[model samples]
Target: MRYWLLILPKLPANAMAIFPFILLKKASQQKDVVLINHEKIHLQQQLELLILPFYVLYLLNYFINLVIYKNHYKAYFNISFEREAYSFEGDLNYLTKRKLYHWAKFFVKSSGDRLG
Candidate 1:
C-alpha cells in the first residue's frame, strides 16, 4: 500500500487520495494526519473496488449527487465514500476495526439521515 504524494498548487480540490497516489494542494498540508487518514480511507476504498471502478463510480456518483444537490460542495460532501471517510478519519485505528463493505452503510441512509 505504498503511495506517492504530489503537491500541486492548482489541484482542483484540497487533496485527492487516488489509488497509489495522493495529490495535495500544498506541501505543507502533508503533515496533517487527519488529512492523511482521510486519503488513506480512500485508498482502502479503491482497493476494495479493484482500482478502476472506484474512479468510474466516484465520478458517476459525484455527477449524480451534483445533479441531485445542485451544488458542487454539496455533491462532494454527500458522497457516501466521503461520508464514511469524513465520519471516521479522526479515528486513526478506524481501518483496523472497520468491517468489509462498511461504507455501504453510509449509502443506505434512513429518512432522518442527511449530510451536514
Candidate 2:
C-alpha cells in the first residue's frame, strides 16, 4: 500500500497510521521497521474498512475495552486493530500474507482467550 510518513512532534503516540499518512512523533522513527510495520498493519485495516468506519469502530472498541479493562493503556492494547498489529508487527512479511478482516478474529476472541 502507498503511504506517506509525516513527523508531528506533538503526537500523543510514537506513531499512528491515519490512512494515507503515517504520523510519527519524531523523524527518526522512520527507521524503526517494527514500528513502521505495526502502523502499516493499521493502514491495511483502514483501507479495508474505507477509512471513516475504521475510526468509528476503533473508538467504539477502545471504549468497550476501557470499560472492561479500566485502564487507558490496557484498552488501547486490547483494541482489535492494535491487537492484530502488535501480534504480527515483528513479522515484516505479515502484510503480504494477511487476510482481509483479520482483525475480526481478535475482536471476536473470548475475553479469557485475549492476550495480556
Give the whole-model CA lDDT for all candidates, comma-separated.
0.86, 0.94
lDDT of 2 by residue, 1-116 (tens): 89999999999888999989999999999999999999999999999999999999999999998889888998899999999999999999999899999999999998887655
Per-residue lDDT of candidate 1, residues 7-104 (tens digit): 99999899998779988999999999999989989999999989998888788878978887788888888888898999999999998988877777
Question: In candidate 1, which residue pairs get closer than 3 Å at backbone N, Cα or C atoms, i.e. clash?
Answer: none
Give TM per candidate: 0.91, 0.97
Winning model by lDDT: 2
- Superposed Cα deviation of residue 81, candidate 2 (Å): 0.4
Query: Any runs in candidate 1 off by more than 4 Å, and if so which?
Result: 110-112
Which pairs of residues have clashing backbones in candidate 2? Answer: none
Worst 10 residues of 1 by lDDT: 107-116
What RMSD does model 2 have? 0.8
